[model samples]
Target: MTAPKAWSYSALSTYVSVCTLKYFFRYVANLEPERSFSRMYFGLAIHAGLEAAYRAWKPDAPAPVGVAKKVFMDDLTIRLEDPMIEFKKGETPEGLLTEGMAVLDVWAKEARYEEIISTESEFTVPLVHPGTGEIFERGLKGWFDLVVKDPDTGEPVVVDFKTTARRFSGDKLEADLQIRVYSYAIRQLYGLDRANLRLDVLVRNKKPVFQRLEVSQDSEGDARLFELVRAAGRGVEAGVFWPNDGSIWCGGCPFTQACARWHDNPDALRSHSEK
Candidate 1:
């Protein structure tokens, strides 16, 4: 008898086959291993920097400098064990820190007109569809980078900050599940419709791209997303864990060795890549 998995966007938006086993390894066996990606550390540093910078940003206040990066990396060093991220074996954190700082600087200038409502806001709500009766026993949990109101129209907007290797168009954002989930979740908690959406993509060695994307879904579209949550919950309950043989995501997954052991030879789990 397995316990019901707590529903979350990370578990739902990803492929069920991959996500289910990830859950199995993590919660069931408590054997999920975590890998440290320098890039992930870099991204977190940038996110923390932006969160600090934005929290101090006021429509009439002077834009502060040198504080955001300082605040973020100060704590990050301890978290990542102060490892020198070897981008090319001799690479240092100087360049990466500068780049993330550049993004905050660019945003400080560009976001003068926007009034921020909230940043790093979080929510956990019952998994239910808006304007529909479909509700699940499991709940959804998530965090928002920023929530602001349109200065001119007084409309509420949700803004997400990203540290991307390349630029992304508004079209891709319009189709992303993460943003849709946020939009839907916001409405459910706030009881407001037409909450605008924006994605601030901070690209390395390039000026930050600010994109305002639309997030509107009909009941069917809403139902589609809710179904993903339902399906994840169902799969977890039935212990329907199976290896997704053809998935591209399997390559980067941390559980490959364990996954191989379950289906392949048990002795070969130590060296998953060999076979």
Candidate 2:
């Protein structure tokens, strides 16, 4: 069977669908809002501001430049260098700084900002049925952030970056499934023997944290991906869209009002007694 069109970052519907699915999963799983609002907002601002600054300063760099041209330029020369000086202990010279700056710029601007804009076009990817030879196309396809060749075994490794408000000290974090899904996608697309997946969380309040997991050749990560896909499919099938009440995360969700209304009155009837 022929492969379908791959999902691009430019599509709006895909973005909305992914976000909706994530909200549903979080609600179903009863994820807690562990971080404070101040910390979350601060982390967002810091990440955005840093990215904007990097874009402005590095015009020739492959990284994304922000909408504000002057600010983007100013950030490159001034703000970008400060991090290298303070954090890297002056180890990041001009060349290394430029390279790292370019990488982050692409990540921040293309991966973060441009993704939010709505697009008319949709992208799709092909998934082969396990039992049948039928190839089904799925919407919203994207690649893992990083892929590196392992120095020891010469195998490919998938690395993903995550920005958060705080650090996770344990061997595994709560959202490792996201990385596992990305790794699974990478494996399917590349047809590689196996991928050693790693997650690097850039904690805004402190130093960055790294977590590594070697996905087994067997169907472990694939199972997780299937679970996510099935859960999302079930949500769509059952029309079980409801807001999880009293979840602090609901405050930030765009569909909170719709969910709340639905939860309060699934019949869509207004409360006449209140009036």
Candidate 3:
């Protein structure tokens, strides 16, 4: 079986669910899902639009948000999906745009675009496999939405972009394991002890609400994230792919068929040959 290049939230989440499923999907599955899930496409469109707008953003003469959103959706070259590709897709592009519009509108109005220090910065931190000396082989990788400086203090801050239709909540952001992981990676990349993390959540509705959260730096939190990743690495090394209690998210899982087969016909799952 092929091993993962690195452990991230996505992989860790999958590992909790059937390691066999993760192994199959990452190393054996021939047919991949069209989109991540039914609701994911909307976020993708919003991310693309935001990237296009901010990548070319200028503080003096800000680019028109409407124009960027329109051009990104209308122009075939800039779209997330191919114009000519015909298939039974997970979600309609138009539907996603309709849902994402209001949130984007909120973001355009309130976000501190003028304070951007950098955009779309990629960071990779070395990760060691629990049983092997493969720090580079399996490293942590993620993208920071924006790195901006506080106008008052000129302190560097990491900004993460997100959108949700539900009521705003900082509880999740405050406890998010990613914050710690990203904090460690960002600190390592910048060589700073105190790095600021911000969560910019844009709520979707007629009257959208903008929620900004400044995540604190926690050494214990950072240690916890690394421990979780290290545990995952151990699981991968031992070929221990047991399913976690993931029924809450199993509704959206892509390996339901294989999972069902494991229950109904256990022998079929044991067959080494990939279909």
Candidate 4:
């Protein structure tokens, strides 16, 4: 007979925190239309599904697995079956699955069996800036999903995988701020030498897209990113959340109703609500 799976408490807490932060970031940063349960659940589903695929590929990697599982189980009890089969069919790999599973395992046991996985691993919460001492008090903390050194230059490349419901038009300038913020944090934590980063967007029903962004140690782009961070900080302090209308993001936004109400009119909000 097979033994029952154990729980990991610390991992579960981190998962809840991360999921909460993601929702907070979108709401506070005005990155999305508004915050709603559907948006949260959808985001969690995509994140979990992709992560499960990664874990199925590399079960030994604790960090990714722990993170992935936490997000999946916390937001949804959905499990990934035949992750290997999903990957072979040209689906995005789930490098974040085990982390997600670890999170769920803890939560389930804690609530049901009263068991938890205890460990000393430091789980960095992405609430404040890891560098520059800037406090995104209202904005959620951000972190890179993956980082690898360039084979030749040994420069670290920060990579983040995003799963969206729609397809990205392969436009770098119009990319999400989360990716750019992540690049900024990576530079600050690892120094300018490791600021090179790339953003990978995996559309659930479309082709995968890649965007390479270089954060030079002394480049104007880096300066801009820092400025944006400062701007975000100020917005957080001022309680400002300017929704981007006509961004093609509102259609899938869960907070559309609230955003429309706040904007004072449906027409005003619709101007930028194209998806």
Judging by TM-score against the true structure, name the best candidate: 1
lDDT of 1: 0.65
**Pick by lDDT: 3 or 4, better one:** 3
The list of candidate 2 runs beyond 4 A from truth reads: 1-125, 129-140, 173-175, 206-218, 264-275
Encode model 4's per-residue lDDT on 128-160: one tens digit a residue.
Answer: 444565644333243444555565576666655
The C-alpha stretches of model 4 lying farther than 4 A from their native spots are 1-43, 49-140, 165-176, 206-218, 239-247, 260-275
Residues 180-248 of candidate 3 have per-residue lDDT tens digits of: 667767776776776679887776655778788788674546555656676766655554443433656
- Residue pairs in clash, model 2: 5-124, 53-75, 56-72, 56-73, 57-73, 57-76
Clashes of 3: 1
Worst 10 residues of 2 by lDDT: 114-123
Clashing pairs in 1: none
The candidate that wins on lDDT is 1
TM-score of every prediction relative to native: 0.79, 0.49, 0.76, 0.45
Mind giving the per-residue lDDT tens digits that candidate 1 earns over 162-200? 776676666666557887677777777777654567777
Instruction: Report backbone clashes per prediction.
Output: 0, 6, 1, 27
Give residue 49's lDDT in candidate 4 (0 to 100): 46
